[model samples]
Target: MNASAAARHPYLSPDAPRVLAHRGLVTPDAAALGVAENSFAAVAEAHAAGVAYVESDCHLTADGAVVLFHDDDLRRVADDPRAIADVRVHELEEIMSERGGLITLAQALDAFPDVRFNLDVKAAAAAESVGRLVAPHAERVLVTSFSDARRREALAAARSAGAVRRPATSPGIDTAKRLVAARALRRTTRVRALLADLDALQLPERRGPIRVVTRGLVRDAHAAGVEVHVWTVNAEDDMERLLDLGVDGLVTDRADVALAVVNRRGTTAV
Candidate 1:
């Protein structure tokens, strides 16, 4: 989005070349201290490291609570065979207590009032609740999902919750794909149409073999008053390269390093 439009959305008002901590930050030291991805500790680490945004995912528990977790099951993080939907919120919290301390969507918003959240609706069941939870904090939250319908559902829920300002959002995979195709074909009209409603285009630098976040795409998105944010980028060199290409933001596991890079460049959009 343009500077003024972006400034109107508190979540995007920060200076360009933003860095979003992907699933929060878990350095070797933090991991050694029992901090886990998407855990409260991880998010706290990112916040302490001075990241403007924390990217996370949400799921619904059997008790209908919206939690900050990435996977459907606890296998990788908890070593439990049960799925998140099958467990009660209390049980899940107990399990995460040892890993890094579980954090509900409500807790995250309330505990870190100044931190902006980039939430992905990982479960359809959590969409409405996520919407409801973030409604009060719409100015500082960005709701997203791989499913456009789910994303829209959460945004609608936020609106229904009486949020005067709509939460910021990025397009889902389907819309992103169409936008990419339109960009590749050089259809300015179609590209603008695709980006009209989006605040950011969160994407990979490349999808399989085809490059997704090219300069042309970034330029087109910026021209349409949208920002482009590349995801899951971790390496320092790659972060610098992408920034040099004029991307508006980077979603990285290493917010620590990204912050350092950005500082060295003086917050310039590049």
Candidate 2:
């Protein structure tokens, strides 16, 4: 349930169609990869290599500064173990990786002005900050989150605070489980809410014991005007299987390989 565990088990289902480069195409097996994950350098690498969308995680610092990061704790990327929200942005600014220094959300937007971003807001309150940070480039960004409440909050903030349009709602795979948690919360309600807000559903390939990305899910999502995009797929066999199912998008660490597969298939490129 921690970030490390989540990172190890990316649930990319078979229903999605497009390829979203995870951490800008830095493979886990590589000894010396590109820039650190979620950094501006990584985003730039993805864009320069013709990736359509690059994904990044966002969290707000203690001082209300929004920045890019994946884990709640800084241990993975920094020497400290403090929660990202607990630290002031200035204090966290000292954190750096081998590729380059840490980058602000605004800096990323400025650097990749034309590239489309898949912004994953890590906290509910951070929604407003994310909205403000991305307001100027709303047309080129797609905001997503594991929390529906946070996504809605972000949408509301964007509409009220800026002229930026609400980015399409793409719920994380984990939200699907909330439907089964309580009787008061209808499963249909969750589906309908997702249908209303999202143009696509960003799901892992698997959901608990269930394979939610079956052909039926794809057909159903598409019927409701929602595209399906799976994430963090690393195997060629799995990739081929998903492609056979007519997914809308794919999120992979190997963007170049996925692009090659799609190209070799001779199917129309997304």
> In model 2, how many backbone clashes occur?
18
Report backbone clashes per prediction: 3, 18
**Which candidate tops TM-score?**
1
The lDDT of model 2 is 0.68
Inter-residue clash pairs, candidate 1: 1-225, 1-226, 1-227
Model 2's TM-score against the true structure: 0.82
Q: What is the lDDT of residue 156 in candidate 1?
A: 99
Task: Single out the weakest 10-residue window by summed lDDT for candidate 2.
Answer: 1-10
Tens-place lDDT per residue, model 1, 94-209, is 99998889999999999999889999999999999999999999999999999999999999999999998899999999999999888778888898899888888999999899
Q: Give per-residue CA lDDT, model 2, range 1-270, as digits (tens).
A: 111322211122222245687766554443265356776666666676677777788888888888788888778776687998899866776665454457778888787776667888888768998887676666667788888778767767777767346665577645655422321344555555556546666778876786667676676566566677888787788788898887877788777778777777875333
Off by over 4 Å in 2: 1-17, 27-34, 97-99, 172-175, 178-194, 267-270
